[model samples]
Target chain A: MVIKRKVAVVGAGMTLFRRRMLETGKELCFEAASMALESAGISMRDVDAVVLGSAPDAFDGVHMKGEYLLDGAGGVGKPYTRVFVGGGTGVFAPIAGWWHVASGLFDTCLVVCEEKMSSLHPHPQYAFWGIFDHTLERPLGVNLLWIFALEMRRYMHVYGISEEEIAHVAVKNKRNALDHPCAQLAAKITVEDVMRSEPIVWPIKRLDSSPPSDGAAAVVLASEDTARRICKEPVWIDGVGWSIDSAYWTDRELAYPAYLAEAARMAYRMAGIEEPRREIDVAEVYDPFSYKELHHLEGLGLADKGKAAEMTVAGVTARDGDMPVNPSGGLLGVGNPIAAAGMMKVCEVFWQLSGNAGKRQVKKDVRTGLAQAWGDLMQFSSVIIMRS
Target chain B: MKEGVVKKGQDIGVGRGIEPNPVGSKYAGIEVKESDLRDGRYMSIRYSAMFRYRWDTGIAVGRFLEGLRDGRIVGSRCNVCKRILVPPRVFCELDFAQIDDWVYVYDTGRVNTYSISYIDKQARRMSSPVIVAVVELDGASQGMGIMHLLGEVRPEDVYVGMRVKAVWRSREERKGAITDIVYFKPL
Candidate 1:
């Protein structure tokens, strides 16, 4: 494994995830970026470069959304780049920032990820209609729910899992969110309540879904030299890896996330982590749907296949339990603002590793943690490993 | 299609039942100084995109639409997978192979699942709850359901595995859109 220069997360910031924000996308980016800079005790003038990530321009009804969010993110005249991989964009944004510092091209970099799904008309999910092949798939008038439902069905079939078993994830994540300050749907509920709730698609209920939200998150990354000199308890970026599979989502097995496994393996290998379940203290896996968290848990090697859901029910993933996952309440509990959702996970990992997660802190001494985001028809996966 | 205009005149001595357009519409505009505008402040660069769709699933979808236009329902079968896909696809998902053959299916199915959406996408309040459901078409693969509107069942009555069938609009009101099937009702 090639060892790159060390980089550290000096600070992080995020706007409240919500259904609507009167602030435009650029304004939200500015708010988050400014807060991140303040937290880092630095100014935009000190930043050497900037990296921005946003999921889709379609959701904002603005093409080249990165460019639109540039100035607000302090990318006006600096060496800046916009990187995107759907919902994976947010986590990937920090990875890109890490590379900027790790490559020794810059000593400090500002990373920003933002999404405004509320701006899309009809429904933001309607934007997903075009995510399909315009020639082949769009003709069917397929909605986004179909793909998720089909994946959920296949996951259930292959894992010998029942809908009731999956409902426990909704119960756990929502209950966990009760302590999250930025959570949108934080509540205490039961598996019985999830099963009794109205289903949007078979095996996928309204409660199982992440709400459309408008939010932004920003993180400031710096070289080891700059980090040590300027800040205390800088969370080091131990390893970063991202991968994208073929866009032909239907051809792949929906029951398993091969891309995520590949991405996690690459990051873990670089981080020299031989056994993830034992070494990693906490995790912030993406969970846009309740089943996805369990699915990703398996893919990240935290648990064996067909075992994540069971482990979840056994309370192994609770904030106070071993191998705590999504202690930040996750996308299922906190609202999912797409790009921002991934960065929110990264921010949570930073807070947890820095001993800043006040109420939702995990029980273990979190010396190392991992955050992963998957998106783009389940084809893109990004992983980041951070250590104190 | 037919197009025309209708005109109605007032009865005796009411001067054509017409009134002048209402006035007093208020409009306000403000201008700010360049200095007050926050010079060098952040301003987003704008961009736009337009996409044209030439979908070929039209052949199978056309048949499905025609079925709705005629008060029937249809789907397509994947010969390789042997699974009938409603709102059918042109290719088989499992094999990633072409699916050229189309199969007609009965409208009768079951409400495999459903949700009562209190608010629309815009967060607007609806006068009545909208029942969005997944209806597993007859002869389709197990657990396979096409999303559609549901009616004639209270929110509490709608449950998984409840049998239902499509309710089409009047023939004269038929359109190629999914809305052509007004809603689904208990079988």
Candidate 2:
């Protein structure tokens, strides 16, 4: 057994997700970090270390963004480090913070994730070009949507699923976002509405996508002793796991997230969870694209392979449903700020486990929750399990 | 590595072919002057870049953009979810789905949520404060709304659920952007 110290999340905070934000990346970081500290009823002086996570430096048009954001994140002159694995950076930030406390190196840590995708000119999707190989892949002039469309096509083919079925995830999530204060694109629509919507790429319509957004989220982590002394009802970090797959995306099957499954297995083993569907009360799966939610649900072991879409169609994943996924409306409805979007999922899990979710509360008593974020050309996965 | 040399006036000529001396200038005494040039050091530089992508709004979003230019709001309905989506999209989000039903929405909507921006991305002060808001259409669901600018209301007066109406720019001034609709005013 790895003799890791107990870790708890004592505070959480976030800025509203939007397509464009007047606040620069640093300002957003400072605002969110300050709020997290305040929510814990502690000051920035109480934080012993800092871990910063931001998706692509291209999104902000800044190089070595970690160092540039240091002052705003309150990491200046402290034991600060930056870690990123594309979209997974959000949840990974807190997990990194967990290690700082779990290793008994720091009593408290401030974890922050920020992304300003709106700053990228001619559309932020252009920034994704660098995610490919400079020599071999860049010459192809591939857009990020091409890959997602190809994967979506593969998923539909393997599962015999229709585009209409996957559209329900968008409908449900956007509807659920009705109660979310920070939602960017929340709406109530039907299957016919989705089917009739304009197509961006074949199979991926305008409605199936998450918008380019600007936002930041932050959380405070502490050791068991520090948690007990500083806050009430601390959410325990029972397990944390992350994994990366090969960069050669074409070499792997696009129909499933094998990396996510492995990452979830590692987390489950550490958290002592055998039957995730039964043990976990709520979930926040990354849904940059609507199909990703179902894809991730299967990866997280919450539903069997090729069955997540069916469960979603059956209303089992709604806020009042048995599983209650994306209670914060998820990245689909709530807006995806990349790194910040993943942290939003973590924050939703924290809120649900603590019964702090006001209007969006699920209909069951929750004790355990799971949150996962995926990114990097579909190569990385990060999982975190929390318990009250 | 292989070593090779050229002999003056033999394999290679120094000047004026065979007519001139291979070694042109000669000094009476050779004085070696060495200066301390070791103080400078070489530095390596690094560069990074991001890719760019072009997105097409498709027919539905194209129509929606046209509507914005025409001073109208539009939404599409999903047969499966049975909800209206503003800024009409061609597919649903939940099930990897598609939507074909389109509906024109009324300009009347209520403020769902809003924020007052005091600065731009450059951290530059604005001549006037800008109020950005999400407005839920009258018949739309609770969360359904279009994000746009709010005008004619003081920052202090803007509140959640405040009923408002869209104010469009002149036909000549419209540019098919969100800014085409100057702002929303309290109804």
lDDT digits (tens) for residues B1-187 of candidate 1: 1134434552343222122222431111111222423462322244446676455546766777677777776667788878777767687766788887777778888765455655443334456766666577788676556667778888777766689988877889987666777779998
* Residue-pair clashes, model 1: 0
Question: Every model's DockQ, to 2 decimals?
Answer: 0.05, 0.01
TM-score, structure 1 vs. true: 0.72
* Residue A158 shift from truth in candidate 1, angstroms: 1.0
For candidate 1, give the lDDT of residue A242: 83
Instruction: Work out the TM-score per prediction.
Output: 0.72, 0.68
The DockQ-derived docking category for candidate 1 is: incorrect
**lDDT by residue for model 2 over B1-187, one digit each (tens)?**
1136655555543322112212432101111111211222212123446457665657777778788788887788888888777756687654447988888888888765555544333323356656665577776544566556678989788766689998888999987766677778999
Question: Which lDDT tens digits does candidate 2 get at residues A1-388?
Answer: 6746899999988887877665678988987898788878899888899999998888777989999899989998789999998989988999999999999999999999998887665478777877864432344334566567656766776787888899999999988898887778888978777788766544677788898888889999999998999888899999888988765465356678989999999999999999999999999999988899999999898999899999999999999999999989999899999999999889888888888887988899999999999988888999999999
What is the lDDT of every predicted structure here? 0.80, 0.80
